[model samples]
Target: MGALDVSKIVQGRQGWRLITCIWLHAGVVHLLINVLCLLFIGIRLEQEFGFVRIGLVYLISGFGGSLMSALFIRSSISVGASGALFGLIGSMLSELITNWSLYANKVAALLTLVFVIVVNLALGILPRVDNFAHIGGLISGFLLGFVVFIRPQFAWINQKRVAPGQETAPVKRKHKTYQYILWLAAVVLLIVGFTVAIVLLFRGYNANDHCSWCHYLSCVPTKKWKCNSSPQTCTVMQQPNTLDLTCDGTGTHHSYSIAGATQDQISQLCNSLCS
Candidate 1:
């Protein structure tokens, strides 16, 4: 009843937990946030597409979120509908774009939607947030939105272009060659990205250290960092003002020894550990 643990999903092979975890909430506060977000985003989608389509999007996006969390976070037990909430946000973005011609103030609506999505995702930088789920749900929802929300006229199946003055059909739209190209490109990129992400996840890549571009997102430079790769032992330095650290490993255990004096070369000694 708690949540789905990544280890169980991976090593224990409890796949049913993926969907079950989405229905569970971490706490009352978490439940409130998801409910509010669902009301805001889910209701509108349901109004337009009806209950069935929106429901499918929510569940599918949530499942996608859980799948990514299981793959990336090996030690976490994740619960909540926030991933699905982000999915709704993503769906709205694609919906707006797919039906852009129908809207009068496209730019304003788009800006507002983008601002909200950015703010929510930025807030995910906080500790304990399941950002991987949000990201997975978002990408899945965005891609699905294009296919799920296409209007009948502008849809690829029926293509007809009408001039400014003359219109035999109620809606005048053409299936442009570029739209098909872009959609194909998006699918290719999505598959490639997911594959790369899985490879890096198994490679034990720390986004904090390995991906410098993402350093600005969730990591902050701290002077209090300590060397955790090896245990340290200090030795009085023969030299008066210099410090040196050496590392050695035997079997599985690793050790680091520092050769230096305190106060005389304290800054250098401490800096060596952090560096």
Candidate 2:
């Protein structure tokens, strides 16, 4: 098909942009890296669990990453399948943890994979990669995999006698109370984690420094007491009056002022009055 716009995919008026954005990416390199990762990890998972389960994991993990990004990174546009790929990796790690017996050498393989990913994460700190999304996806995938794949049950148990001559001890079933506790803990952790992510995202996007009033005028410290109403009506305030004033970037020209106060002083006064 044709190229897709990530902003369009994720820019819903209400909030559904989170779902659509995961499928879109910025460029060829971006698309290739994610696709390769997915192909390697996702295909294997699908083969084991069937397509439906794999699809569910991908969707959930992708959405989790998008939600986190939307809440945290407001200025820059983000588009990629890296989050979903990371989630798949997390799932693979979980599978290794849960079924160590069936999958021989899984522990070693997982450790290697973990090492590679950690190094990549460290590299991500240098520049443009959205490390937060990668982390969110990985954690979400890991949690989902643990819940779905590792439910407490003894899949292997020997109860019947192999032959009449030989008697064997009945295999005892291990209590799954700990597993249940772990499941509960995982659920609680996921909820708390997502909540914290959302809060931080919102806080970061809507920082006090990005206030409309503060950025509108470009007044310096020395000319703090001047108020400019418009291009024509630049006025210097005799006293510090808490009124909104618009100023050009330089102190030479004040765009306009609401009262006889500097923009900073006006903002403070407004906050105090509102409070």
Best by TM-score: 1
Give one digit per residue, the lDDT tens place, for model 1 in 1-275: 63767556545656678789899987899999899889988887998999988987798788777766655444447899877888888888987787676678999999999999889878765556777788878877787677567654344333245456653544334544444554576567657766675565445443433332342232222455322234533333344444443211101111224345556354454334322
Number of clashing residue pairs, candidate 2: 7
Q: Can you write out model 2's per-residue Cα lDDT over 30-71, one digit (the tens) per residue?
A: 889888877877777887888888888788887777765554
- TM-score of model 1 relative to the true fold? 0.66
Best by lDDT: 1
Which runs in model 2 stand beyond 4 Å of their true positions?
Answer: 1-13, 101-103, 151-178, 195-275
TM per candidate: 0.66, 0.61
TM-score of 2: 0.61
lDDT of candidate 2 at residue 131, scale 0 to 100? 61
Task: Supply the global lDDT for candidate 2.
Answer: 0.58
What candidate 1 gets wrong by more than 4 Å, as runs, is 153-179, 182-275
